[model samples]
Target: MANPQLHLLELNAKTGEVFLRLRKFPNIILTPPRWEDEPLLIPYLNDPRVCDWLSGPPYPYTLQDSKDFLARIKPPADEVIQHLKDADPAAAPIIVGECPVWSIREVRGSEEVFLGGISIIRCENGELMGPNGVDWENKKKREEENNALAVGDPSIIWTIGDWLAPSHHGRGIMTDVIRTLLNDWAVPRMGVRHVWATAFTGNEGSVKVFLKNGFKLVTTHENHVVVKGKMRGLHLLEWQYEG
Candidate 1:
């Protein structure tokens, strides 16, 4: 069984517009992926950095691989609802956790959708190694630091896995996506206290997004991520939402 932490839900394409309801942020429409988007998703999955974080695709990715993955993500049975009570509301609209997971999509012309990105909450008890490099002795210390930094309330760390289409890059699409996610979680529900994000030191693009969205740099590792075989520095960031 899929970890109850992760479950899928389907929404009527019309209601899915709830995904695009944010008028303040315009670059993104929060709709599902259309069947034609498989072509777009393929290149995103095949992108060098994207492939690094994901498990499959043997280097030069093939179109067939993309098609196969989509075939696996069949459409929803009926309208779906995901409930994520313990998740950080300031992160992504796609909630993924022990509570619930939501997948946002763009409605197609008549009856279809497209997949966007996955937003997840990863819990750590100070014993596990986090993306930034906390293990054993340092783990407890970091957790304590995080707790102290949070000033006593529970800390909900956030991370995003965005395979955003290239055409969408630099267009403020990501910013729109994040704002909508925050709005949904900040009102009429449990509000998140803080959010965490990490980016390879050189990824200026992602760094900007996090900053623009309110995430601040908390720490940085001189050489953290190993991509294509080389260790690169990483920046650890955080954000707090007030609603």
Candidate 2:
């Protein structure tokens, strides 16, 4: 549920481009990352202030790391790019899978500043159901249980993750980003009725962004995960479309 003051976004398929325009901040947009953004990611992602909060990107983020990440997302991105480029009048361009990412940028004339990244990943109940981030010894049972659930079948379940360049902190940029994603882009395009978000308990700024976007605090999982050899409590939030 986004702030009603902001309206829905249209990802025009016929334009052959994938970008999200913010209603409140017209200059800022979310687009797929390009190869040229390698150096940009290095500086932003390697900053300890940003990487420390993230579990995915490695510390001292390298060019190879960027390449690997970009390569992994290439398939789906290519699909969306192509669809958007040559889509029929009736086609609705979309990128659907376990993880769909976007690069947040502030467009300034011909230049686009890479602020950070965001992802809306489709997840399973088995993963979300667990409080402790632990590996099971019974590998066979784990596989069997996970196999039982189909991919994106119950499309209603999903979660979001995001990180911003340290410079962009305290600007309420991420808050509007989530608002635009839910109320504008993701809701209508993906039919995402339910979204869950989690942040380490002490990360109040991150938690507040989702809160501003209408997510309600569900519960805090104490010592739910280990980051950098330190156990951290996690706050889980839930948002359901009232529409």
Candidate 3:
């Protein structure tokens, strides 16, 4: 469970943006995505080196794709938060699982530049099952298997995913960000346990990021996905909270 004191956050009422300070690196912050971030985000999505490993969005990612994606995952309105507060004043204003994405940025002088993005979603049986095209029976079986491990309800298992801009590569920025998110925010604020992640076999950099952040390899799916007409393997990783 989240610390009650950290439940409600201060947000910019006009822009609906909330800023989170990085524990060790106070200059960096995790903020809500804004319309102006399209340019910063789209380039990375369009880059073959980056998008090839990712699952969704057609390559040569367009302005429209960026617009559509942001719209789909936008956080709830202020009125929704107010309603939740009215119902339960003590509850966290924003449910971590409900809001799936946050933009990672660094404060430079008076401006903050978008560096990358981090996301988490609730899954069942360690699988990314969403509202569209779901298999309930399979999900049930997976949940049973997951529950048997004494890891709590599999249906509520939260998975973490991230992507960083190419320009910021090799700086260890993402590794540090992932660690802070898991330790300071996700575990403490979201009460996340058994967080999951997957990386393509060839993507050694991402594999290192997960491993360094304390995720253990659980399984490998050979040729699980096809990208650019070639088969690719995937390694599944998990981080379980003991405390």
Candidate 4:
């Protein structure tokens, strides 16, 4: 059953500010990345403890890398205003990669501090193949398989990914973030039926977060990623909206 209280907040069309309201922490908001966030993002991306688990933004992340990432993930300022004015959450435009990414920030007095990032990518007619063995470089074969399965234009599936600054660890912040995104945004606003996520085997914290948000364990992929010269396993989880 859907939670009646789970609703998306209205975006301020004039200011172009998008936010997800949290019951416990009203000051925390999930919004689009801003130009001022580059500095806050750089240190987190460069942190070995943080970057090792992520698939992109090469080691020793730089300012240029941060700039490029912001550019790629954030939509144009004018487009943001338009989407907010439309008053339809699902109508918000995503930048390149067809993924909607947002910055998790905590409002402190007059300032908002960047805490982390979250994103969801929509994949249509794609199987929940374990993440380990697939050769993503072979785009042709993957496309063929997807096209074959998409004959009738099947329902869209979504994959979620997130990262938080080391400073925010152990605060239960991400757990709430995941829950809010799934219950409020992904399922209700975006209307995604199935949502998937992957976490490295040793990262018990992330696995717990997904489980708390109702994601069931699907499979484990051995040696799914190489972290700091060593191979690591990955656990894939899924959440299906019954409504």
Best by TM-score: 2
Q: Per-residue lDDT tens digits of candidate 2, residues 1-243?
A: 322212233343555345778778888888776776777888877787787777778777899999998877766766645544454434444433332338888989877788988887653224454445433344444445544545434435677889888887998899988888776656765567778888887788989999999999988878776777778887888898899
Better of 3 and 4 by TM-score: 4
User: Poorest 10 consecutive residues of model 4 by lDDT?
Assistant: 92-101
Candidate 2 ranges beyond 4 A from true positions:
1-16, 84-87, 91-101, 130-155
Deviation from native of the Cα of residue 168 in model 4, angstroms: 1.7
Ranking by lDDT: 2, 4, 3, 1
lDDT of 1: 0.50
Q: Residue by residue across 166-199, what tens digits does model 4's lDDT show?
A: 9888888888888776666665555566777888
TM-score of each: 0.59, 0.79, 0.76, 0.77
Q: What is the lDDT, from 0 to 100, of the residue 167 in candidate 2?
A: 85
Candidate lDDT (C-alpha), each: 0.50, 0.70, 0.66, 0.67
Q: 1 or 3, which is superior by lDDT?
A: 3
Ten residues in sequence with the least summed lDDT for candidate 3:
125-134
Candidate 1 local lDDT, 140-223, one digit each (tens): 765655444331243645455454555556766666666665555421222355666667777787788878888888777775
- How much is 28 displaced in model 4, in angstroms? 1.0
Evaluate model 3: give its TM-score: 0.76
Give the TM-score ranking, best first.
2, 4, 3, 1
The best candidate by lDDT is: 2
Clashing pairs in 1: 10-80, 31-105, 31-106, 32-105, 32-106, 32-114, 33-113, 33-114, 34-113, 34-114
